[model samples]
Target: MTELLTVDGTQSALSQRYSSALMNTFGAPKRVLVRGEGAYLWDADGNKYLDLLGGLAVNCLGHAHPFVVSAVTSQLATLGHVSNFFASAPQIALAEKLLGLFDAPGKVFFTNSGTEANEAAFKITRRTGRTKIVSTVGAFHGRSMGALAVTWKPAYRELFAPLPGDVEFVPYGDAEALAAAVDDETAAVVLEPIQGENGVVVPPAGYLQAARRITSEHGALLWIDEIQTGIGRTGTWFAFEAEGITPDLVTVAKGLGAGIPIGACIGLGAAADLLQPGNHGTTFGGNPVAAIAGLAVLTVIERDGLLAQVNAVGNHLASSIIALDHRLIAGVRGRGLLLAIELTQPVSDQVAQLALEAGFVINNPIPNALRLAPPYILSKADADSFVAALPGLLDQVEAG
Candidate 1:
């Protein structure tokens, strides 16, 4: 006979050791994940989970993809790290491939993470000699001090007082607000096509176009931060592609290296020349291994025709979830695989807990929103499984 225990539980041995050794910046992880293959993760307790969050939208190629692994291993064996003084084939090739995606000839500056990518863009904005930068509300560029300056969340910004000055915020999705905010003094207008961190809030149509017109009119560079929305996450190489406007600068990272650390600040047109020889630099920013990882990620996506797959699977996932007709669900909004399930009740956290216990990984980004940034490789069948289980989870949450 089993005894019913009232006390919840304690951390696993690995988790206990983690608490003592690692910083608590992210709090204690929900599960001590041991391994990953494809879109599934296994914890230390041998519990399997469907990874619907995709490492916060970083693992577009899924986990431990053989192509990326092979590319990184080969590059590391051949030429891993090189000072910025010397260039490598992978770095040059990756830069060229990235620039090819843009309409105009652009230059690429690689960084190790999304924050560093935004940091590079922030510095580029300063090169215009105009200190003021216009950022929209709900914007999340990164955590570094320079990137933090342009970010909108008060809680994230308050601790780091006096973040780079002369930054203004306008209401997102409001073209008129953007027009009113920009002026001759504005160096750049930073924006995210879809506000990823703010519960995957998508902007209305014509907003990006209006932004381009306003920034162009004011002579302010338009910097589009695509860290969370770019690299085929939106069924296109870049989310801004659907809008058909050329941005002065675009920063991408999350899915670029297939889980390896890599990000890039791509400057197009005249913005390409903004950064000169002495303007900026980094040690491992464009290391060959990271560059090769980026190359392999891109190559596989292209070879597999995954953009079409993303669109098909994303449409299917959204439609299937909506088809469930669950009363708790309000709707779903997003492009490609980066979607958000809007809950009628503010019980997303509870629903997420239920989802985890049911062997699914999800994120309650906001009280009423559950964000899903699953890997591009996620099949319709896999998506259907989640959709099938969702009703039961919601029922459990609603009951409680």
Candidate 2:
């Protein structure tokens, strides 16, 4: 057993240890979280906090869900890791389940994370015999070389020079811009149903349908990056369902396994056959453990009717936050549980810090945006508590 230590002492020790052993990729740690349940997390000193960001929208079922835990534990005892050379029941079952979620005929390629899923999709796009791929400005697909080539963030791409060429970027949600970007040479047009990293930015109505139309006109694949929006995060099984369009290719992760680390690249209709047997593969992509975790997440989401719950709770939360009438609050953006509180001033980081001190966790993706992506199972009372505290948190930030 370990002895208890003060919060500051424990946090400082962990930070020092991490700095000495780990790379400075993500900077210092915020706090040392010891435990989590549902929508709340406990720091080492026993300070409880409502987790509003849900680990960047990856913890749809929240931390340590019974279903996920049981599924992972059982799968590990039954069959843990297996090479791609052999097939597992959970793997095939998950693939079928993911394909069924689209309510269409398609194939799936599993991966360990969203970036790898995008990488696989990138390779599939190359199979179209066209080299050019058009993605939106302010769009984030992944960080790997192939996916990074399509990503628009200069800060991330600038350091990694000479990325895979033949990629173009156009303004997101601008139908005319996207229409002009895609041509016969374009292999695919990629987009996010709602941009999560970019302050939970929501595109104009019919934007996705417009992408589908434009890509169809140019004989290019329409790829929707649902890595941050899929698996009922946005109150729908897939965010694209609300757009009323079928994308040829879809990349998903984040919430699919409810923090179990799983991702998939799905191809619909003719695009299903784009990647042949020898085209792509991953050794641990379809491992039984991760597949079972994903299956359990889907099962629980359906069994608990969390999709409708997300829509109802998300609307209530947004309305409550807006009704606060705080001077700093500009507006709320995003759909379902994926939400962002737009601030009038560029003090989102301060607001987030204040919220954290007030026993709530939120994210400041940009200078003027505070993002909230609580778990699907988050109770109304918990949400109301956070809403009630928003005005006070904002007041603290404004004072300083």
Candidate 3:
């Protein structure tokens, strides 16, 4: 029989154990979480906290949702996984459903993560007989070699030198810069609509449309990385839907499976058949369990009208924070539940720690940006509570 650990064990003890055993990749964890429900998490010391980050914006239905739980359980009992050679009902159904969300004819290539999805799209772009890819600065596609080539962060790319070349970096949201960078030799123009990891920076109006127009004019494909902003995160099925432009390639992940690992690279129009056989594949992608989980998440979002809820709650939170009139809070950026509170001073790390002490879980994605990507199911009452506590949290950070 295995011995059960008690909550009396302090987080420091666990941190030491983790440091001794695990790789020094993520550094030391802040808390040892035991369980979660809805938008709350309980730590080893029995401290409960409102989870505003929502697993880095991947828990749209909150934690341990009943629909996802039941779907995963039933599907696992019936069919867990099979070779990609054999297709399951849920796999076909999910692909069809995702294509329907686009309201267009397209094909999907499933993967287990956002990086894999970008890698698959990278390969498809290569098939266009062009090697030049125009990407934006401050963009974070993924950590893989191919995806890393397009990511603009120097700290991440400097260590991993000699990445795949022929990729050009342009200033994000600058239509003229993007147009000047692209030509007939460009294979695709990859962009993230909101640049979530870069402190939720939203591009200027019509930026996406300009990219679309420019890519079309240059005979290059337009690829939108919607891994962080898709599937009801931005109060729409896809963020590009608001821009009224059809992209050649769309990559999505994060909240698609409502916590289960799944991602997709969707090729639209003629780009659908770009990758023929023997080009790309995955063993665990599109498996029955993850597909069912994604189906359950989509079903719950539509059935519960979570998109409208997200808009309402997100607006309230943003407005409330702005209403605080605190000198520390510079402004709020982003749409729907994907939001960032820009601080006048570089005290985001302190604010996140203070918020955690106040029973709220938030993230400091950058030095001066506090990001809040709470679940779509976050109640207005909980949002109001967070707003009520914001001023005090800022004061605490300022005091020190």
Candidate 4:
């Protein structure tokens, strides 16, 4: 057996070594993950952890799922990387499957990551002959130059000075603010149905519908960035579906391929034919292996009734967390599996670390918001176990 890794100073040593070798873009690395299976992961020193964050909401079916493994292995053995010049079975099939999920007719452009997907959509928006874009104040599109232009955080935008011009920011969930910003000159109004990176903030009722109407009236495209909220993460296939609105451009990634990196920028209605040949291209955008992995993920989600499971288990998990009756437990907020617990103090990260030491894995996206995006296939018992351990973790954070 591998020697167990301690969660204390020894882990700090390993982290220090990592900092020496790598540029610290994301500050220090969390515990070095060694292996993962189902909803659990093992650290470099072999300490087991219940991974509630799921690689920042990437692992929908969980880690090392047999279906995902088999699909990728078989596809690789048959045909791996081919250029976009040629079409692959899985590639075309996955695109068709995605279109089938949406009521609106559209076309898809695949990419290797969420940022790339948004970049492709950004270029498509430019093709509308309108350069202006309206986005939310706390929305996170991606890290690419074009995506960063529309992404609303000034800290992220200020560092990369001179982003693409004609972008406007409005307060999220405010239909009036969105209407005030979007006009006939605007190419698209981009939104996250629920702002994931801003700590799982769900919008007000009728917010999305109002945006759709306002953008439609302005002759502007309504783009919903579903990168972190799509593909069964929020119980619905797409969160916008729950709100009863169809966007002109929809970007998706993260859980689409379970872990295999893939993203799609889908254009609906009149926005479909904006890009022609030579408008955009990518080498590894829609690799057959990645597409096969996506098919496997979608297949499992439908076959195993994971959507219903997500709703049932998610409701229970959120209710249980709220029932803890601790001062730190302000409330549980979110839909489906994408839940966040608001802490009274700014010790959410401390609570997360303490929980990790106790073999539970969670994250604090904000100082007082503990985010949880466990696998769609997560069992009720596992969720209950985490809830049971929460009081102790809160106590540890409080003591510290």
Candidate 5:
């Protein structure tokens, strides 16, 4: 047995050691998290924090929930890892379950993460024999080469020059530009039902319908990147449901396994047959453990009526934050639990840091935008507490 290091522990020393050993992608660690339960987390220093970002929208049911834990443990005990040559019941069940959420029948390709799921969709689009793909400006699909080709930001794409070419970018909400961009050679048009990475920018009404009409006219596949907006995070099973359009392909992850790594690309209608057998596969993609976790999450979401809860709490939080009328808060933009509070000044990063010090965890993706993706189980009292603390937090940021 390993001996106990120390009561207080050498967490800082260990963190520095980790910095030396690990890659410098995310910069320095932010007070290494030791443990989590429900919406609260404890750092290595043993200070508790209310986690509002929900691990970047992965922990939908919250941390260490019994259902997720039990499902994972039970599946591991029964049958852990299997090669892609063999199929598992949980994987097949997950595929069927996902397809059921859509009115149209589809096929599923499981992947280990969002980028990989998108990679699968990328290949599917290629099979259409059209190389050009029309994407939106300010879109964040994924970081890998294929997904990166469709992402619009130059900082992320410029370094990796000569990416798979023929990706066209149009203004996100302008149907005219999108319509003007799509031609017969366009394989697909990709969009996030709600642009989560760009400060939760919701498109105008009929924007997606316009996309549907345009894609239909050009025979292009309509792909929805629901990676951050799916699995009841947006008060619906999928954000595209709100748009009232049937997409040819839908990529989902983030909250699929409630923290477990799992992503899926679902192809609907004729697009379902595009990827034949032997086209793509992954060893860990559809493993029984991840599938079990997904099953548990879906079951719980259904049984507890969490979607309704997300709508109610999200509306309450958005309304409350807007009512604060603080100078920093310009507006609250987003749907359901995926909300962002826009600040008048570009001090969102400062506000986030202060909020953390004040025992609240949040995310600041853009300079003047703070994202809040709290768990679907966020209590009304917890929501109120966060709303109550926002004004003071903004004041402190401004003072600094």
Candidate 6:
């Protein structure tokens, strides 16, 4: 054990050291997780916890997946990172693989994370010679300066003054509002098929189709941010796939590389060649290790047929929660492995706390929402275990 975590009474010591050494951005650490396997995690105190949040929807294949581990390690040993200055086979292959997922001819720009992917998309929008962007209410794109400007949280936006301007916010799921807000001179209309960070808030049917129509009519780009809902997290190759609408820009990350840091901003058709040479570049965007990890993840997902499994297990998890007939539960939302348990009362924080104490790792995204984006490999039994314990956790919150 390292000195930071090996001190007497691990939790308290680690907590103090963490506060002193790191900036307090995400408040105190929830738990110093030491190890993870599939859907389970072990903390520094030797407490085992069932991970239902899946690293905030990042770990689609679960923690320490053997295939991803093997691919990344093998690539590292052979040809680690030959910067963008030199082309590598794995990098080219991964890019080709991602583009093949779409029916239309497209090009991809690689990045290190979802936010950077969105940032690249933002720059692509600028190439259209338009300045205005219309996003939606309750959309969580990412936290970087450019992505945060489009994100619709006052708490996040208020602190960061004078963000990139001309960004507009309209009511989510409102076709009229979207159509009205987007007009000529609009660079892009960014949206998520389902707002994952906003407690898995899914939009109305035909929403994406309407968005496509409106943006197309106005000659504005339809940029869909699939950071949380892509990579089979929503039971499809991408959450937007079912809409049958091809977006101009699609930014994907999170589960794309399983747990590895990788993301891509894909441009289809005319939007593909907007960024010219010297327009944008990345130092560690398409490194071989991360590329292999992404390739391995995509390969495993296909070989194991986890997309079908995601739908089955996800449906079972949602249905089981509803069957519990708990008074606190308002309903369930979202599709595939990304789901939210809506509570009748604003006690999600308390319930999540209780759940953590009960050896379950859940997330309270909002006051009345518990978000669950477990791994695609999560078994029905693993989901059932959480459902079995949920009532008691809610009861503890109600008793107070």
Model 1, TM vs. native: 0.97
Output the lDDT of residue 309, model 6. Answer: 98
TM-score of 3: 0.98
TM-score of every model? Answer: 0.97, 0.97, 0.98, 0.96, 0.97, 0.98
What's the C-alpha lDDT at position 99 in model 5?
91
Per-residue C-alpha lDDT of model 6 across residues 1-400, encoded as one tens digit per residue: 5566443558777888789999999899988888899889998789999899999998999999999999998999999888788999999999999999998999999999999999999999999999999999999988899999999999999999789999999999999999999989899999999998788899999999999999999999999999999989989999998889999999999898888899999999999999998999999998999899999999999999999999999999999999999999999999999999999999989999899999999999999999999989999998999999999998888899
Per-residue lDDT of model 4, residues 113-219, tens digit only? 99999999999899988999988888899989999998877888898889998888899999888888888898989899999888899999999999999989988
Which segments of model 5 are wrong by more than 4 Å? 1-11
| Residue ranges of candidate 1 with Cα displaced over 4 Å | 1-11
**What Cα-based lDDT does every candidate model obtain?**
0.93, 0.92, 0.94, 0.91, 0.92, 0.93
Which residue pairs show backbone clashes in model 3?
none
Question: Which stretches of model 3 miss by more than 4 angstroms?
Answer: 1-8
Judging by lDDT against the true structure, name the best candidate.
3
Tens-place lDDT per residue, model 2, 1-400, is 7868544557678788879999999988787798899999998767899999999999999899998998899989999998998999999999999998876699999999999999999999999999999998899999999999999999999999899999999999999999888899999998999998889999999999999999999999999999999999999988999978999999999999898889999999999999988899998897999999999999999999999999999999999989988899989989999999999999999989888888999999899999999999998899999999898888888788
Clashing pairs in model 5, backbone N/Cα/C closer than 3 A: none
Q: Any idea how many clashes model 3 has?
A: 0
Q: What is candidate 4's CA lDDT for residue 181?
A: 84
lDDT, candidate 1, 62-146, per-residue tens: 9999989888998888998989999999999999999998889999999999999999999999999999999988899999999
Worst lDDT 10-window in candidate 4: 3-12
What digit string (tens of lDDT, one per residue) describes model 5 on residues 1-400? 8967534555687688779999998888777887889888888888998889999988999899898899899999999889888999999999999999999988999998999999999999999999999999999999999999999899999999989999999999999999999999999999999998899999999999999999999999999999999999899999988878899999999899898999999999999999987887787997999998888899999999999999999999999999999988899999999999999999988999999988999999899999999888898899998899988999888888
Residue lDDT tens for model 3, 1-400: 7759655567788778889999998978988898899999998778999999999989999999998999999999999999899999999999999999875699999999999999999999999999999999899999999999999999999999999999999999999999999999999999999998889999999999999999999999999999999999999988988899999999999999989999999999989999999999999998999999989999999999999999999999999999999999999999999999999999999999999999999999899999999999999999999999999999887787
